[model samples]
Target: MNDFERQLQELFNEVKSMIMMGNKNDAIDLLQANYEAVNEQINAGNKGIEEVAILDIIALGYMYIGDLKFVQSLLDMMSGIVDSLKDDEPLLDAILLHMGSMYSTLENYEKSMLVYQRVINVLESRYGKTSILLVTSLLGMAKVLGSIGRAKKAVEIYHRVITILELNRGTESADLVLPLFSLGSLFIKEGKAVDAESVFSRILKIYTKVYGENDGRVGMAMCSLAHAKCANGNAEEAVELYKKALRVIKDSNYMSLDDSIMENMRIDLAELLHIVGRGQEGRELLEECLLITEKYKGKEHPSFVTHLLNLAASYSRSKNFVEAERLLRICLDIMTKTVGPDDQSISFPMLHLGVTLYHLNRDKEAEKLVLEALYIREIAFGKDSLPVGEALDCLVSIQTRLGEDDTKLLELLKRVLRIQEREFGSESEEVMLTLKKVVSYLDKLGRKEEKFPLQKRLSNLRMKYKQKVQY
Candidate 1:
C-alpha cells in the first residue's frame, strides 16, 4: 500500500478499537477531525488518491454508525474525484466496490449496478474471468437484477457464480451453497416449483454430505426442501420433512428456542398443519410461539401480535367467536400502540374483528370496524388494490346483514366485480363468482338491461369451467 493508504489504514484501526471499547462518540470525533483535515487538503487543490482514501475511510465510519444520510453526501463528493481518475487507478477497485455496496444499501439500484459492473471489468482485466475476486461483484450485480424484477437475468448470473465457484473449488464444495440457495429461492418466488424442488433437493444432498445429516445446516436445507415440496403439491411429504427438520434443528441447538429463525419455522409448520386439517396441533404450536415471544420479547412486543392473530384465526375457524374476538382485540391494541391506528397492518386485525363481530350477530359494530378498515386500506393500497377489494367484500357482507340500501349494495358489488376482474382475469372462477353476485344485485335493483348480459356471461363461465373440470 502507498504511504497515505497505510496511514489511512492505521487511523481506521484506531477507530475500530475505539468502537470496540464503546467509545463511539470519541470515534465519531476522531473521524470528524480527519474528515475536516482531508477537506482542507482538497480545498487547497490537493485532490489525489490520498484525499480520496481519507474521505472513503470517513464515509465508511459513518456507514458503520448507520448514519447513511451523512455517508451519502460523502459519497457524492468521492464520486466527483473518482470520476476524474482513470479506470487503472491503484485504489479504484476497492473504492468502486464500497460505492456499489453503499448505493445498493441506499436503494439506488441504477448507480449500484453501474459501479458493480465497473469493478467487475477492472477485476477481469487484472485476473482472468473465473477468478474468485469476480464473485463478489457478480453477486452484487445479481442482487440488483433480482431487486429490479429481472428474475431470469438474475438466475443466469447466479448460475455463472455457481460455475465459477465449481471451477475453482470442485462441484461438491460447501461454497456452492450460497448461490444455489439463492437460485432455489428465486425459482420458488417465480412459481417454478419443480425447478425449485430440484435445486433444494440438491442442496439438501450437498449439506448432508458435507455437514452430516444431524448438522443444523442440513436441517436448514431440509426445511427449504420441504417448502419446495409444499409448493410442488406434496403436502404430506412436506409435513413429514417439517416435523423432522424441527426435531433436528432443536436437537442441534444451533438456533436457540426463542430465536426468530426457530420461531418462524414453528409458525410456518403451524400454518401448514392448519391447512392440512390438523387445527388442534396448529393451535398448540401457536400457543408455544406466543409463550416464547411473551417470555423473551415481553407481552406487548410487536412479535406477540402475529402469534395472537394466528391463534385468533384458529379459534375463528372453529366457530369460537368469543375467544377469537378477545384475542383479536388484544392483537389490535398491541398493533395500534406499536405502529399507530393509521398503519396498514392495523387493517388486518380490524377486518378480522369485524368478521368476528358479524359472526356474533353485531352488525352495527361490524359495519363500523369494516368501514374503518376500508378507509385505512384505501389510503394505504389505493382504491382499486386487492387489499381494498378485500375490505370492500367484508363491508358488503356486513351491510347486507344490516339490510342497507339496495342501490348502495349494488354499487359495492359492481366495484368488487371490477376489482376481481382486474386481479383474476375476466374468465377466472373468482371473477365468475363476482359476476353471479353482480347479476343478483342488478336483478334486485331492477336493472334488467345490465342483468341480461351478466347472466349470459356467468352461464358461459360455468359451462367453460365445468368442461375443464370434467376433462
Candidate 2:
C-alpha cells in the first residue's frame, strides 16, 4: 500500500478502537483532522485514488458516529471526480463500495445502485463473472433493487449470488446461507409463504449441519421458519416453533436480554398470541418487553414509547381501556418530551388515546385529541397522504359519536375516499367500504343525485370483490 493509504488504514483502525471504547467525540475530532489533511492534498492538485481513499474513510467515520450530513457532503465531493479515477485503481474499488453503502443508508437509492454497479463492473473486469469477490457489490445492488420494489430483479440477483457461492464453495457451504436467508426474507415479504417456508427450512438444515441444533444461527433460522408457518396458516405449529426458538436463543445467550432483536421477537410473539385467543399470555409478554426496554433504555427514553404503545394496544384489544389509557398517556408524555409535542411521532399515541377515549364514551375529549392528531398528520404527511387519511378516519368516528353535522361528516368521508383512490387506486377494494359510507350519508341528507353515482360505483366494486373472492 502507498504511504497515504497505509496511514488512512491506521487512522480508521484507531477510530474504530475509539468508538468501541465509547470515545465518539475523540473519534470525530480525529476524523476531522484527517479530513483537513486530505482536503489540503486535493487542493494542491493531488486528487487521486489515495485522496479518494481518505475521503471515503472519513465519510465512513462520520456514518459510524451517526453524522449523515457530513457523509452526504463527502459523497457529493467524491461524486464530482470519481469518474475521472481509473477503473483498475485498487483503492478505488473499496472506496466505491463504501460509497454505495453510505448512499443507500442515506436513502439515495439511485446513486447507491449506480455506485454498486460501478463496483460490480470493476470486480467483473478484474475477476470474471463467477468470482466470489463480486458477491459483495452484487448483494448491494440486489438490496437496492429490493428496496425500490423490483423484487423480481432482486430475486434473480440473489439467486445469481447463491449460484456463484455454490460454484466456488460447494452446494452445502455455509457461505450460501447469506443469499439463501435474504432470498427467503424476500419471499416472505412477497407473501409466498410456501416458497418462504421451503427456503427457511433449507436455511435451518444448513445452520444445524454447520453449527448444531442449539446454535444461535439455528435459533434465528427457526424463528424465520416459524414466521413462514404462521403466514401459511399453521399458527399452532408456528407458536410451538417460536417458543422453541426463544428457548434456544435464551439458552445459547445469542443476544442480551434487552437486545432490539429479542425485544421484537417478544413483541411479535405477543401479537401472535393475542391473535390466537391467548390474551393473558400476550399481555405478559408485552409487559416483559416493556420491562426490558425500561431497564436498558430507561422508562423516559424515546425507545420506550413503542413498548408502551404495544402494551396499551394489548390492553385496548382486551376491553381494558383504563389500563390502555394509562400506558398511552405514558407513551405520549415520553415521546412529546423526547421529540417535542408537535413532532409527527406524537400523533401515534395521540390517535390511539383518542380511540381509547372514544371507547370510554368521552366523545368531546376524543374529538379534541383526534383533531390535533389530524392537524399534525396533515402537516407532516400531506393532506392527501394515507397517514392523514387515517387521522381523518379517526376524526370521522369521533365526530359521528358526537353527532356532528351530516354535511361535515359527508365532506370528511369524501376526502378519505379521494385519498384512498389516490393511494389504492380508483377501483381498489379498499375504496369500497368508504364509498358505501359516503353513499349512505348522502342518502340520509336526501342527495339522490350524489348518492346515485356513488351507489353505482359501490355495486360494481362489490361485484368485482366477490368475483376476486370466488376466483
Give me the candidate number with maximum TM-score.
1
In model 1, where is the ten-residue run with the lowest total lDDT? 46-55
How much is 296 displaced in model 1, in angstroms?
1.7
Question: RMSD for each model, in Å, please?
Answer: 3.9, 3.8
Model 1, span 33-81: residue lDDT tens: 9989989999999877778878888988888878899989998888889
Check candidate 1 and list the clashing pairs.
none
Error of 1 at 370 (Å): 3.4
The estimated TM-scores of all candidates read: 0.83, 0.82
